[model samples]
Target: MNKKAKIAVTRKLPATVETQLEELSDAKFNLDDTPYSEPQLIRAVSWADILIPTVTDQVNAKVINAAGPNLKLIANFGVGVNHIDLEAAEAKGIQVSNTPDVLTEDTADLAMGSFIMASRRFGECERMVRAGAWTG
Candidate 1:
């Protein structure tokens, strides 16, 4: 029988996603929602076939170099991969990926809202009201 692949997720993901991962693989999740310390991250990579990291986790060269042979992928949960060491992953032949478009719509909405609020001077009005400087 083929053994299920082991996956280690560094942060708390949605329950639906975690359930799916658990069903398909030997998945380990950080239910505490805290970012893994360096030693904890190293141990996860040492045994996992895949590592799911968020922006908070630093997947630097030291962590990459410590990964076992079975660790073939580092799938970042967020769009930015600044915390991960791309060069090291390349040298180690481990593929890296991220969910880039997931925040596109949300980002656009925030920008539009900010523009509207700024144009209307909402912040200034709110401050005046709070400071009791505005009436009628």
Candidate 2:
């Protein structure tokens, strides 16, 4: 059998996504269930052909530089790339891509719900209930 393309995932994802990737390539997920430190991230990027990263993870210039010649693409799972060093990736001729439009409505709905809850004193109501304020 031909060797599969090696990819590294920096965070835990749903099983469906894992299965999808596994069908096409060999994926290495973070086994410790913890975030990777800078040095660990650098080493993983150095060995990975593709990197799947989350927004909370920092992919700075140092990490980008250490990706070496094997790194071809970074397929970010989130909609934002603020945590990644775009200039450094460009300098190294590495391609960076992201999954956009997937969380737009979900994020917007969460923001709206949070705003309403904050405006309506929902926390105060919960506190009242917990404080035995029911008089009916």
Candidate 3:
């Protein structure tokens, strides 16, 4: 029997997605609370057949070059690809992909809620309550 492909997850992800990957391939997840540095990220990519990363993690040309020919896919967790150098990845023959429209509604909702709260002086109300100044 052929062995399953190995993948490296560069950051923490929701359990639902992680479970899906666990069923599909050999997945290694980073458990440390701290983020991985560039050198550490390069080392992880060197051994992976696929890489799963977040928007904050940068996958640059140097990192792609250090992949050592085993790396195949990069699946980003966010819609933005600013952190990745697509041209460099293409030049190195690595496939790159991102999750689009997944969190659009949620992000917009949160932004609207924050705007409402700020405009209504919600922070002042909370501060007054904490200071025992509620006369009602």
Candidate 4:
């Protein structure tokens, strides 16, 4: 792999993963974890050979078009490719990839956790406390 191959990551990933990316390639990370604006997205695509966008980043036609000539891949961080314009990517000969089923177990665990929390009225209790309505 070319050490100069530029990879733009649109969100802050886990520290270990980010470290690996840094070690493996010329990875540019969005350490702030904020959603990229249209111009920022355009800039990222313009600069990167590959982009690692998350659910929050919209890889639309405009973004695809803004990609530099070297840009070849859009590797999404999440399972949903709906955020990306697949037709436009294909038209531009940019390959789009994603980690499908990546969140299956985590999503299920969160669902179950939320179910238990709701059943226990944990949110309501927190609200009560926040509102200074706790009697006990």
Considering every candidate listed, which one attains the maximal TM-score?
3
* Candidate 3 global lDDT: 0.89
CA lDDT for candidate 2: 0.90
Q: lDDT ranking from best to worst?
A: 1, 4, 2, 3
- The C-alpha RMSD in Å for every predicted model, in order, reads 2.1, 2.0, 1.6, 2.2
The stretch of ten residues in a row with the least summed lDDT in candidate 2 is 31-40
TM-score of each: 0.86, 0.86, 0.90, 0.85
In candidate 3, position 102 carries an lDDT of 86
Clashing pairs in 4: none
* TM-score for candidate 4: 0.85
Q: Where does candidate 3 stray beyond 4 Å?
A: none
Instruction: Report the poorest 10 consecutive residues by lDDT, candidate 1.
Output: 11-20
Candidate 4 lDDT tens digits, 1-136: 3457799999988789888888888999887899998899999999899999999998899999888998999999989899999999999999999999889999999999999999999999999999999999
In terms of lDDT, model 4 sits at 0.92
- Shift in Å, residue 18, candidate 2: 1.6
Q: What lDDT does the true structure give each of the candidates?
A: 0.96, 0.90, 0.89, 0.92
Q: 1 or 2, which is superior by lDDT? A: 1
> Model 2, 28-123: lDDT tens per residue?
999776777898889889889999998878999999999969898988998999999999999998899998998989999999999999999888
RMSD of 3: 1.6
Structure candidate 2, residue pairs in collision: none
Worst 10 residues of 4 by lDDT: 1-10
